[model samples]
Target: MMRSAALCMALCLAMSMAACQPGPAAPPQSAPTSSVAGPPADSAGGATSPAVTSPEPPAPAAPPALSAEAQAQLDQELVAAAKANNVPLVSELIGRGGNVNAKDAIQDSAFLYAGAEGFNEVLRLTLAAGADVASTNRYGGTALIPASEHGHVETVQILIAAGVPVNHVNNLGWTAMQEAILLNSGGPRQQEVVRLLLAAGADPGIRDPEGRTALQNAERLGFAEIAALLRGHG
Candidate 1:
């Protein structure tokens, strides 16, 4: 009976030792995870930095405005340059904001002076600089009238091509064709000027203040070439 009792005690002690031992270690305790996301990877599997945007460039500044007196001085200088046929100076002045059609005290703008005086270089500059093509002079005539009267053949051509009125009559009731016939010496230049006028749609039948046609004026002035041209056009 004692043997049996000692055997029972040994079995109880073994069970108590097994229960005191730790259970599996508990799984190590995983570290806390962050909520922030990492940068996306490129096709090559390398870390890509965040994209940085560049700022827009500033706009260009506006040109400075000129005062009234300064503008008038610039216009005066341009007129003087045109009158002298100084092409370079005229170009410079025009670039500096000189008004190409600004008239002086005598109603003669740079364009008027250049066209009337046959200053072809200055005339071209003024034209390119936006000269008023239909602007009149002191005599209330277009640039074409004086150009025709002065026997400037090339000048006549230029004015006509620039859209000057072909039949524009001056305050004196004279057309370009009439002035070319009455005021000129019936020369080759005058004859050519008449031809250009007729070709550009100048009406030879338009009467003057004296109630005479361009043909009659040519006939009265004995301009055979001009008379022939007027008759042919009619």
Candidate 2:
């Protein structure tokens, strides 16, 4: 009986010690993993992951197909605009590819007709836009010839200063000075124009088919002042 009680007391002490001791920790589990391998990249929205961006499209080119009707309308407007001395409209047309030196059915470019009609502003504008100052009409009469023929001294002076040939003979074998002498229009400036042409190196002795010099034409037409001016230059 003593041995049995001793054995029971020893077994009860063993059970109490086992209950107080700490157990081995379960195997450490790996941290929750992400589906992707690397860290996320930054985005435009200030977010960790960014979206792909697309490229922008290019601009379209202007059209170049000009219709016949449109061209006719533009031509009419350009002619009228030139006649009216509408510098702004003329410049606009020229800027939009309109021809500043285009000739009409009468074989007159805008500049030629403008100079012929004494459109001084139009002449200047056309010249500034690259109009041919030396362009001749179908009759082979240049701007300077007509201007001088009509006794338009200012226009003639402009043409002369613009580098026009002062002695250009038209198809009728008449120089500007000869035309001035032959014409009986008797404008307010005929004598002055005759004198100007003579001063600008016009040969007073040049004869036409009738063998009449500019001085002879003046003499026949009774332009005493023009004749005197030519004689003085001679």
Candidate 3:
């Protein structure tokens, strides 16, 4: 009886001890949240920053080279040199392959100035360099016609010998023969130019714009010898 009573008392004491102990308390709550500065997230509602771009610099402009057209224009120095009566320069240009027949803006060839100005060497050089003997200026005046008009007897002979068309009537309806008699002073030199043109077979019968033949013009201009020469041919 004593043993059974002792076991029952131990069990009651164990139960009382378990009930008397306190239950575990609830878990502690965390503090309010805070955000830290860091790389932005895609899911965030905030607007994204725009990307920056650097512009490229422009390329440098290049210097231009002389073109063929420009070279041709600059080569017209030959024509200008002729007009300026620069014989040495003209000869130099000719020796350097400058275009002997090169024309100006007005279509005046180098041969015209050389003949008109009585630049004998220039004329010879231009002719030898292949300048057109029969080429006319803008006025329809050949080198021979102007040489005749200017009473340049030597130049007239030179041009005539070079095969310039003698009876070529210009826009003014005048041949070299008529110009030698009518437009020039009735001096001995002018008379000699007329004789040369006549010898070259210049058509003495060709009339001027005024319906006057070279014979009539010579007679009226008081060139008795020139008139007599024309009458002899007629």
Per residue, candidate 2 scores C-alpha lDDT tens digits across 22-76 of 9999999999988876645456544375567887887655335568777656655
After superposing all C-alphas onto the true structure, candidate 1 shows an RMSD in angstroms of 6.1
- What is the clash tally of candidate 2? 0
Q: Which tens-of-lDDT digit does each residue in 93-125 have in candidate 1?
A: 988888999999999999999999999999998
- Output the worst ten-in-a-row residue range by lDDT, candidate 1: 56-65
TM per candidate comes to 0.73, 0.64, 0.68
Off by over 4 Å in 1: 1-63
* lDDT, candidate 3, 1-234, per-residue tens: 999999999999999999999999989999967776654656676656667888888885543454777646644888888888888898877665677787888887778888987988888888898778889988888988889888898899899999999999898898888888777787888888888888888889899988988888888878888888778877
Candidate 2 minimal-lDDT segment of 10 residues: 38-47
RMSD per prediction, one decimal?
6.1, 10.1, 19.6
TM-score between model 1 and native? 0.73
Strongest candidate by TM-score: 1
Return whichever of 1 and 2 wins on lDDT. Answer: 1
What residue pairs are clashing in model 3? none
lDDT of 1: 0.91
